[model samples]
Target: MPAFEALQTVPRSGELVDKAFSRAARAGRAKEGIEAQESMLITAANILSDNLENVVTNWPDFDTVDPFYRELADAVCRDTEGVPGVDALRQNLSEVGWASRQIDELRSEYQGRIRRSGPDTARKVRKQAFARFADICDEVEDDLLALGEAREALKTLPDIRADEPAIVVAGYPNVGKSSFVNHVTNARNETASYPFTTTQIRVGHLTRERIRYQLVDTPGLLDQPADERNAIEQQAVSALTHLADAVLFVLDASGDCGYPIGAQLELRDELRERFAGAAAADEDAVPIVTVCNKSDRSRGIEADAYMSVTEDENVSGVLDLVVEAVGHEPELPFDG
Candidate 1:
């Protein structure tokens, strides 16, 4: 699973303000005279600053996030109305961080004034600091709201293990892509919804020679052409460009899947081009192995392999081909 799943809920500005002030009142009641005012100031400042800072810290550093997750986050935000892209998310977090520091500085400055004044004057100084604290919180209210929205959006991402070798199952809808994944993996496919569309991303796993391979079927995102896809789906494809170690392009030659063989070939070509472009920039190429599913129905198409998922024919052979194409070399320990 991606690390974003563990992110804490973002604290709203108003809720944080209320909680800080209420806690400050309790701390003040436990003290006397100028000391009481000082206590209140310290309590409020610490609570607000810590919480605001925590909100900033809780998010994974976008710069250091895995390219797959980072791009996915960017794609998620592009479709989110009123929510800016990844740069904006970084800026908002920076702003909230600045506000938190300002509150801490205000606390130190006000504490000196409270200590130098009489009880009545000290109380007034404390009230003045509270007003500034509230103002600061209000200043970053939108940033806080944006962070909350981002949290809600990102937490919904599928728990994809990035370290494992991933074989992405991609083809047009009803092309037996999901059926192929279901047949190859050990257990039932774990269905997870994509944040951008109602369609789900199904994940299943199989272990070969002590290496676990992840099989993913991205239904709504990769099942269409790049030009025909919306902004959200394009970003999703970009994510896969980073995530996939190999791609299994399934074809339904029978046209029983309702897509023409030419269309399936077109999508396969697009994926090949896309992955080929990515490979040029990296050390290794992500291999795409095309398999014509429902081979029992039709064998007219040219592909790397053939399988009938429904008939359980050559299914394991197709899985073998995918694992071989992935070509993930595991690290060996030093004998020394």
Candidate 2:
């Protein structure tokens, strides 16, 4: 559930135009001669203008959006085929806004013309207004279609709260990241697929001292290097950079996760360097807790913490280290 969850389904241009005209025709039928023409013109224009404005207003302003959500949205948009990028989305919204204003102007202009004309001429003026409305909708048909695609692509984003302190659980495949999260957090973990990627991420929550924490496990997105990633994957990694308060880089030093310990550490180094640049620029150093999972099999490598998820060996201790590294204070209801 992203901020885009609130977005209403965008109507196709032809569908919207047809609905407005059908309703306008009903309004016209209820009146007589010039009044009927005037009624139809007003009804059609209002319907088009209001609906277009609603579409534009429903979208969050990308510039002001929380960086986590903004980056997530951008990634989703970029990965989606035929869907435009964030800048294009903003431009489409601007075009829609302009169309709404243009419709209002056309309504006023044609209403004047209809008022000055005789009954027969009034009908012609209304017809002209209807033509213009149809043309305007046609002009933005692609923009509307792009918006609809964006909505479908973005609406499925995992409902990770940007306001909450988030701990990203990252590592190579089969590193026990999800298992660790499930073991520590009693909350149900949600699995969601990112657009265009086979990768699915898990989000879980835990509360300590009444402070809720979000645990995110991105399987494919954060499991590798920036150089190995496509543009869309890099954008998704950027989203995590904004969302994470701290990172738990799981490592299976026992070589049970298919990847060798050295390779795993290399990935860890890549991630550390990635976060370091972000932390420096933002002035918030995201601490990486190297967790050696499957300690029962082999705790061959040195790490900040060691855990065996299946056997429940030092699992809680590992969580304690993560929470401490996050260092987020619980909000007090009353000031001292």
Candidate 3:
């Protein structure tokens, strides 16, 4: 069967079976055995649906409640089991609840007393009384949201397909890195008329003729600061170094501003040296493809001898050069 047909039909068939059982159960089939069997079938169908959704959508199926809740419950049980202070912790929580109620009662009493004394005392006491509770509430809300967002962010990280050819693009600021990505993959990434537009690494898949490659567009590298570096940007660089099958060293042919062309060329040479050393040691070391972009803009900087482009030429020649640089056939199919 065709892949899409298989994807669509299998899930629908499972849902049909689930619906059949559900409709029967809802209608007067209240026998304990029948209802139990139907419930089991429904649960199985839901689990199948969740897995299928994950496959089709290329995302973690977090919308399904059962698995997440089950995992949470299991984790709680594991952490709480055989711990010496488990009972003590529960007791302390109960005591904390009681203490909180008592504090509220005492606060109410103080407020009543202050109200009788004077308006100034009443306002001051009330403010002081609730300040700690308000602070606690704010902290709890912030912590919970932070935890939720952290979990969500963790889920958003891509699951690398085994043996996929991952191509990473790296460059200094205003090097037309994203423009090159868009040119090759037609990715529709956020491109701008200025520099530093790509603040984060944007990953997309390109299937040329049919060969699939994972392309990553990393944020432009700025000179490292003394106090600290952008950890996220560093991670982006690390991803290219470690996970990529090939790295495209994108350079600005225009060299319009910031960072001398000589410096940028030296950076590419250094990268090539490092990559060559790694390739010598490890058979799987990624290759480097040096590409000078923005050929449409006129600048006096000398282009790389191997893959130079004219201002009027399109990106196909550069892409072809990249394919050759990686030692892959330009017409390779996607089946691999």
Candidate 4:
């Protein structure tokens, strides 16, 4: 899933109207009678309005699309021109429709004017309609460009596969959470890397029983409560909260992670609450597997009741626990 930023794929409002009116003018160029001549104007109006409406209709419904992407799309994207929320895209679409209908209404009025007058006067009426159409499209140009900006911002979002199960490793600073992820993925058949827009998070992959799973490691964030984090760090929370099928909440028993055992345990509790909340909303939301790392070193606190790594290089147990939690391991062709 690439960032949703291919706004260049969508035709600009100005360009759409220009092409419609130009084609309309060409089709009506040699017409003689008033009705035939005015019919061309109606045809052009329909083309412009219909094309505009089609573009809006084809856009991502956003409300019913991927939850992973909807989270990113609904936020306010900042640029040189800044506004409030995710409504910019919808707002621009609405304005285009309004302007298109205005053009349609103008065409009807001009058709009447052209029918009652001399040939030259009728030509003037048609010119007035074209000018009004141009003016309306120009007025909504900024809104269209704003939509383009939003699309560009969303384009840089992390390409997480919403279909794959995710194993999110979280804990305090200096915990070997990332190291464990690298160990587990590299130990498997093959490894694939997925980079997030925020540099704090890194993604890895592993395949088991012909099934691929995502392994995520967040370096500096997710150790504290949600409100205490910055905007960028909140992104990590969003991923951990929504996308995680299983979590490995690691605790560095050696106190080398620069946080006390008490703080590490507190963070674990916070993570549980978040997962519980998600579980309430979604029945399939899995629980966290608490892990204590670096048992080889001198330390006081343990990684809690789940599993601890004495080898520091071996994370097979943690991987197995994660596989169990996700409950999606493929059955092999073997007799028990």
Q: TM-score for all predictions? A: 0.97, 0.96, 0.46, 0.76
Model 3 weakest lDDT span, ten residues long: 1-10
Relative to the true structure, candidate 2 reaches a TM of: 0.96
What would the per-residue lDDT of candidate 4 be over residues 1-336, giving only the tens digit for each residue?
Answer: 543644444567778777978887777876766655686677777787676666566566667656655555554353345442346677777886787678778877888888897876766777677777778878878866766666556656655777788887888877777677777775542222212233355678888878889887766566666667765456447645778888888888777778888888888888888877877776665678887787667445654333445474446866887788888755568886
Give the local distance difference test score of model 3. Answer: 0.46
Best-to-worst ranking by TM-score: 1, 2, 4, 3
Residue 315 lDDT in model 1? 93
> On residues 1-336, what C-alpha lDDT tens digit does candidate 1 reach at each position?
586998899989999999999999999999899999999999999999999999999988888888888887887765246343688789888999999999999999999999899977999999999999999999999999988888888898888888999999999999898888877786667787767567678899989999999999998878999998877677778888999999999999998988899988999999999987887688677899999999999999999999999999999999999899999988889989
Off by over 4 Å in 1: 79-84
Tens digits of per-residue lDDT for model 2 on 53-168? 99999998888878877887777775246343677798889999999999999999999999999987999889989999999999999889989988987888788887789999
Instruction: Judge candidate 3 at residue 287 and give its lDDT.
Output: 75
Q: Name the runs in model 2 displaced over 4 angstroms.
A: 79-84, 333-336
What is model 4's C-alpha RMSD?
5.2
Residue 205 accuracy (lDDT) in model 4: 87
State which candidate, 3 or 4, has the greater lDDT.
4
Instruction: In model 3, state the lDDT of residue 154.
Output: 34
Which 10 successive residues of model 1 have the least lDDT summed? 76-85
**lDDT values for all models:** 0.89, 0.88, 0.46, 0.69
C-alpha RMSD in Å of predicted model 2 compared with the true structure: 1.8
* Higher-TM-score candidate of 3 and 4: 4
